[model samples]
Target: MTAVSQMKCACDSCLCIVSPNEQAVQKDGKYYCSDACASGHSNGEGCGHTGCDCN
Candidate 1:
């Protein structure tokens, strides 16, 4: 099978795309764009990527 090189952040509201094997934050088998998203934004933080407002 072909490997996945990129995908949308697993966060429900995130707009950033990430490589699952690269700079992605893995949580419960899902790939997120940042630590904030990986933690469910419990700290009122966002991924901080340009154009993404997920928090």
Candidate 2:
């Protein structure tokens, strides 16, 4: 079987694809691209990646 490497960020509004073996943030059994996404953007912050307006 092929090992999973990359997947979309867990945040509903996020458009980023992250590598599970890299810096992807793991939260509640889901993978996110940033801490902001992991926390559901409660502080109204974006993921800091350009072109992604998730907050």
Candidate 3:
């Protein structure tokens, strides 16, 4: 299999794809597509991504 360079957001319900070259949020060694996910919803109520209920 090809080497994996991109990954889905660390948030359990998020559907965003995160790439090393992209400006994604990093928290506790995990990659998140937005600050809401990185902060574990501390800054906001949820991930805010469509169809995602990460909170």
Candidate 4:
């Protein structure tokens, strides 16, 4: 699927804000400020859906 560049946080992690130009190509359309945050969630490091990064 295409990347989502302008969506708000609806996931468990809502602390970090989504940048205007930043985007994440997640299966569930999850949005994060950076890859590190997304990766963290996937590894169960931070707050997010299960397997969040791989979405």
Candidate 5:
């Protein structure tokens, strides 16, 4: 298989793709597309991404 260089955001409800070459956020050994997701909330209470309600 091809070498994997990117991955989906670690947030359970997030749909963002993360790449080591971008500004993706890193937390607890997982990668997130933003600080909110990395902090466990894409927004203040949940993943701010549209349609995602991860908390």
Candidate 6:
């Protein structure tokens, strides 16, 4: 059994091309499996906050 959450990370990245979003879930919206994958957007790390939260 898994948690009642569905997160997914279907974004663009060099790694994503060969490797699927190894860290992504679908919790109402797409999400990364870990913070690293979504860390480049927090605190304005060029995450494109205006687009999707990288953090």
- Model 2 stretches with alpha carbons more than 4 Å out: none
Top-TM-score structure, candidate number: 2
Q: How would you encode candidate 5's per-residue C-alpha lDDT over 1-55 as one tens digit per residue?
A: 8765899988887777778567778788888877878887635676566766666
Q: Assess each prediction's global lDDT (C-alpha) against the native.
A: 0.92, 0.96, 0.79, 0.50, 0.75, 0.39
Clashes, model 3: 0
Name the 10 consecutive residues with the lowest summed lDDT in model 6.
11-20
Q: Rank the candidates by lDDT, best first.
A: 2, 1, 3, 5, 4, 6
Worst 10 residues of 1 by lDDT: 46-55
Superposed model 5: Cα runs more than 4 Å off:
1-3, 42-55
Q: Rank the candidates by TM-score, best first.
A: 2, 1, 3, 5, 4, 6
Residue 29 of model 4 has an lDDT of 55
**TM-score of decoy 5:** 0.66
| lDDT of candidate 3 over 3-37, digit per residue (tens) | 65799988887788888457778788888988887
Expressed as tens digits, the lDDT of each residue in 1-55 for candidate 4 is: 9764566554454554454454553434565555545564565455444444422
User: Candidate 3, after superposition: displacement of residue 6 in Å?
Assistant: 1.4
TM-score for each predicted model, relative to the true structure? 0.93, 0.95, 0.67, 0.32, 0.66, 0.24
Question: In every candidate, how many clashes are there?
Answer: 0, 0, 0, 1, 1, 12
Q: Ten-residue segment with the worst summed lDDT in candidate 2?
A: 20-29
Write one digit per residue (lDDT tens) for candidate 2, span 1-55.
9988999999999999999899999999999999999999999999999999998
Supply candidate 2's per-residue lDDT for 49. 100
Show pairs that collide, candidate 4: 27-55
lDDT of 5: 0.75
